[model samples]
Target chain A: MNGVKSESVREPLILGNPSLGDVSDKIAGIIESPPTKKFWALVTITSIIALQGLCSVAYTVWVGPGVWGVNNPVGWGWAITNFVWWIGIGHAGTLISAILFLFRQKWRTAINRSAEAMTIFAVMCAGLFPLLHTGRQWIAAYWLLPYPNQMQMWTNFRSPLEWDVFAVSTYFTVSLVFWYTGLVPDFATMRNRIKNVLGRNLFSFFSLGWTGSTRNWAHYEMAYLILAGLSTPLVLSVHSIVSFDFAVSVIPGWHTTIFPPYFVAGAIFSGFAMVMTLLIIARWVLNLHDFITLKHLDNMNKIMLATGMMVGYAYAMEFFIAAYSENPYEQYVFLNRAFGDYAWAYWSMVSCNVLVPQIFWFKKLRRSIPAMFVASLLINVGMWFERFVIIATSLHNDFIPGSWDYYSPSWVEVSIYVGTMGIFLTLFLLFAKFVPMLAISEVKGVMPGAQPKHDHH
Target chain B: MEEQTLTQPVKSESAETEASAHMEQPDARATSDPLAVMGDFVDPNEVTDAARAIHAAGYTDFDIYTPYPVHGLEKAMGMKKTILPFFSLGGALFGLGNAIFLQWWTGTLHYPLNIGGKPFFSPWFGMPVMFELTVLLCALTTAVVMFGLLCKLPQWHNPFQKDAGFRRAVDDTFVVVIEAKDQRFTVDSATNLLEKLGASNVRLVNV
Candidate 1:
């Protein structure tokens, strides 16, 4: 807002021998992000499909989870897999918005609006999973609180499921708060720019009467700093709790100390990959190349590379630990996954999530738009495989041999999966069409050599 | 939103001359030198230009204050970069101190309790609060420092109050004031000097 002051009345603020390259029409275009439409078709179709998936999920809740293919040895199946996949996708937004903000990474402003939107919507998708998986659709609220019914039934607080309610809700709330707070100032900018009467009012309502007063700017900056600080630890904890839902179980393969960090790293890795895939398309379609520069894409590639390596490490470490644990049952769980009925899924996971991301080590690949796109798509596929291997391998070889059975998803299961894809794309399409998917004002704040020569603070 | 061409008057201006002259005539008529006799007072703009010349000639005690942050006024007057970090440090230390003290009070001194064989006093668990406190303190301190600056807080009146409407610092006008308190400053000379510095307006404050 201080920047908005007319430079006319006085001479320019910094009468430096500065170049006009950064504040030119090209730079202005980057700041004022345009809309994209390429994904709109995909988003619409996905939304319809996701809505059907929602119906299937809701139907399963109404009738029971029995309508589909999950069974004794493979009780978790694609429902839980999709749950983990969606939750992992949700992780990147928080990391980008929170961690990068703390580091003063200005490039984060380019991707954070879309990323946070991704986080909120992905959480919506993630929350639906556990709700549907429970089967008792009407009784979902009971799980939220530990209360005695008329029959004096007390829900077990000791269960990791209870911890999940707290963790996921907290993560969602904090993320929502963080996302909304960042939007307020931008909303003020929009409010000031709107033309039509109703549109102006709507923008103003959300902007909360921000006047760009120094006092407000002071507090707004403080709150943002605090939220970023709060979100850093939060990003680590939320997925760790999700991982605990498996690791805390008595299941032989699932009971491992490494799940916490492994899950967190994989979440971040997959999240970044998803962010990359969307951002690349977003930049191209929206014509936001200036805001979302090669620099941003390159930085994301580095994270993907780092996280991909970490995810691969977790996989290897899990294999090594299972082999050395001296427990036949745990070792068999690992072996069964490699040579089991789902071995294709397991190998796909390893190759896509692990090997392909290594391409980013080449700076050319990271900087090249097409190369980054291909690598990002591969990372997502690899992440999905990672979840499939985790869920399928663990559920396949239970303690009883007679109860063992190979799990295959029915057409209904496949359709629901497609529906989720539909839902994700549908929402994403809307984001591209309407939202100012890039942070314009923040980008202006980060121009090199723009601040006073000395520390104004 | 509205495309208004906000072209304010260039250096040589209108009622602006009257506003500056009003602030200086009290100190200006002491000399009827040809330069001073221009109008029973050197027009405030002319003296401000002279002060800027003195500034370019390198004198340190002179300072500029505008109703708003001026673009080139600081360099035009040759002011030193301020020591806001001193206050920022004070704030950071304040936060660090608070976080440490809070943890000490609650964990070590307050009633210590054990839950699940965990120490009630693990300041480590309270690390989030401590971290938040440090940032909170530093941020608040910067505000205090800024207050001690631009507004010179606690006391309501400001030294920059050479003109009643100069309160436009919060909105528009940029002003430069040479203080009566500075050793290098004499009321008569400071006013005359600023008149020549191309100051759109200049004045001496009672400070």
Candidate 2:
């Protein structure tokens, strides 16, 4: 009995020794309390930014793809770059919720609800770039899907682009359902506690009459385990298919077998950085430092550090493979990436993706709020440039020098990217306000004395 | 913290229903009354004990409820393992079959075009779509079947909701409810048994 107790015992996931009711009151109270002045200010700012991004999308649809800076050789410019970056940003959420949950990372319960929300919002932002880039947005459905139309043409199953349609759409749908399944119990808690009639009715409808019965929990736990199992593979597959978009192409820099794993690492790295950036501000503003503890921040920073090294290793491997292949086209692409016109972007990627996270080796910096907050921002910037360096640098200089030209985003392109940020933040803010940002039920489950005591022989 | 005082059993104020099933009379009460005796428990260990005691007393229709899933309580109540994984497997097979048919038929038979001299139908290229669809279908089936069919959730009018004390189950308290429909169930015996086994705020409410 003593041995078993010693093995299982550890620092509590939640701090201040909160009781189960305190856990409910602390989380649900965020939603019940009237909106604070700071909350309104942030909402106003993000909503305005989101509106601007929506307008940019509308303008692009009205004006055509010519409004952006994509030319003959550099056709896949900021739009594709932003699409990949946004999608990569979403990977952290699933990594935390599905992957970490399977590994029995008890600390994830504090932040998984919000991280999954961020994942859905990030994917929504990611989808906008691809949808708007289609030029004729109205007819995109026909082009993307294998639906039977009067044209009698089937979407090319062999094409990686066709694979992307299934990969991303399936990813979004599955993530949404997985997130909602976790939310149902939390919603039931809201249903029982909220004072207002309208809020109560809404929670009642969404909660699905969850009574927390052990019989029902038996089924609910099974369903949750199954979803997490499915999402683990689905998350890896989504980004691999995204990588297939570039890898399947015959372009010198793009055609590499290493793209899938490399892209996945970079996605997790950037996604964690974004999560850290948002979480730091959220914990501070919401006064949830006890729940979103320094330990959680330290764990996240370590992940960013590990994934950052994977990305750095992939970057070096790409160069070595380019030189070893005895192919001048590949060699030139790598050389041009580092030494030619877009050297600034390449170096930025290296510094941010490779160099910046090295600061986390110091335990103090990893746990320090200001140090991590700034590092998270720089890492995301580095990731964005990493995508741009991959896309624009490869496309800008072609086989023949005659077709070579510089690529830069037009105002519309720049605004659209910024607008997506606005849209993402606005949705996150709304979610933080209206929903229990912490998984209330889950957080309670991991608290000290949460489980029934058992005597071991 | 005042709510955690469990030294004495606090009988519910609104036990307006007839308490006809006292220890003196072990027989059935009037059939008109649909009584579900609920006991509010402060600790999970105590709830497990009460559930074990109630189950051992030959009552088959009883449940334990808590704010979150209590690990041993399901075993203490003797719940059968759910078959949700089987449904998930069925969904995966269906998705895999559909994806194979769609790709094979469309690529080879429906409209075959020679692009870059690649084969019309190769499983290598088709794997991504197949994997995505399989996961998507499996996830959907698990969620829908678990909530809608197996658990019978989204039931806004659950009989337990009529008892106001039941609200604490989702908040802090662990609850055990022995349905009045149980053959061995009597309101007085259920209430007396719960109070005897260290449950606080015992009450019988018509559901």
Candidate 3:
């Protein structure tokens, strides 16, 4: 098969020459049968990790945000950093499902379902941070909304935080609907394939009595198209609004017009990396080489390479603009980022996000599973540090020299970050075991000779 | 066994004559309270051809079911375009207006506070939320409206679900069902048409 060029040629997405029956049977089998020992082992580990995160959140809520690390100089620390990191990781799913779909990328059909699931779960993980960041989350959560109150107090509509409330929540709702709508027909397939009454009933309920009627298919296809159309902008707008949370500020390092596009490109960059990390393992574990082929992995790595470069350019531009603008504070911030106390993080971000992904420029390394996996893991690390650098470095060293106190994350902050990973992995593991990780009907659509020939007349 | 016999070519002169003859007389035997006459086809191509023949013969109350969506099957079935887009548009407009009005009312009128000397109701600042709410409502309305109003889903107990051949509709079979309630439906005529159009099995199902 041809590699990662956007030429007008049809490559067989499903390799190994599997028939339609074999495709359905193999994918649906994972969900139908009992979980394997490895599946149980992975689930158990992720569950424990998730439980740790839950406990960390509980302790943070119990004591206050002080349990973590946040002082006068650096108000936003690891919590916000992890929030941005997780949110960025969620971007790839929508990009794969909506953007690539609009571009007619058939390679996406093999991976979109799991990617969408990853988006939802990652958003769920990301949502936990903002809530936990608020010391009194119970009250602070409701206070974020603009519901009428006895005191007639309303949330400031001018605040980017309020805009964020609408943006992220709308994003979650749209992603969930888009994900479930795609699942309906596949759920019907499961309902017919499974033998257990309970399993059949559950699938049937979700399937909504889908008969695959031509009329139902017609409407279903239209609704799906409209949703994809709507989600494309919604996905871009989500990260843009997230960037607004930083760009709207007047702080020397935070206030920049390029934050929106920079953050979006970074989000997709980290998202594709995370998808690669997960799919690489999943392809091996689930024996999905025929579906999630090396071709798919190569294409994803190329995206990581491109977006990583875009992020790298953003990094360079920020420095260039900082020096060119001749703003002392901005120059100081840039200098401090490179040679300051947080220089370790700055260099790490540079090496991981920018330098490491450059290896994918070679065709062999791009196709190498181990190299791609390592690069993806490093990219995730780099992306997380990228957020940390953006949030902590800028905040730690303010304009006034008196307030330049170094900040370090306490154990609580570290645990919460690790716990979010647990939550993400746990949800993903369950999704892999239960839901058809591959979109069966879509895979069929891309299979060779699946479509019937129609007369032009 | 019965499917083999049903696939035999009808021993008649022309499809038009047979269809008109069936339409002229509503046979009592054919109208004996049968729920529907269902035909199963192995290939989607055959189903598409059968759908064309059935539609051309002027059967309006027929439906085609398949394992996966068959392209061009809707055109062959002569189905009309759905009204779901209008619902989505309406929802989007409502959401946009509501967001604008709510943000304006809250930021400007209800409990306005001048922060950093910025305007109370900045439409520029509110654009993201407005855009988000519009997309949110549009997506949700499209899903609910299509599933609830158009597809009329959650129909857990459709009579066709009991048919053995119908089970394969979600697996590897294509089926066409013509309701007996149609003005021009007769058992022999429907079964003969389905067979002539290349159906593998034609069975009459009770509601």
Taking the tens digit of each residue's C-alpha lDDT, what string does model 2 give over A23-79?
A: 888888899988989899999999899899889888899989899999999999999
Q: Please identify model 1 stretches exceeding 4 Å from their true place.
A: A1-43, A146-155, A455-457, B1-207
- Error (Å) of candidate 2 at residue A170 is 0.9
lDDT of 3 by residue, A24-50 (tens): 788888887788898889889988998
C-alpha lDDT (0 to 100) for residue A331 of candidate 1: 93
DockQ for model 3 equals: 0.40
Question: Which is the winner by TM-score between candidate 2 and candidate 3?
Answer: 2
Clashes of 3: 0
What are the per-residue Cα lDDT tens digits for candidate 1 across A46-146? 76788888777666766787877898889888888888888889999999998989887767876888898898888877787777777775776766653
Tell me how many clashing residue pairs each candidate has: 27, 1, 0
User: Which model scores highest in lDDT?
Assistant: 2
Report, to 2 decimal places, the DockQ of model 2: 0.56
DockQ of all candidate complexes: 0.04, 0.56, 0.40
Per-residue lDDT for B1-207 in model 2, tens only? 243422222345642321222112323543547678888887778888777788889899888878899887887887778899999999999988889888899889988888889899989988998998899899999999999999897686875675556766888878889999899998889999998998877877764
lDDT string, candidate 3, B78-106, tens digits = 98887788999999998999899988998
Candidate 1, residue A261: lDDT:
96
Q: Candidate 2: global Cα-lDDT? A: 0.88
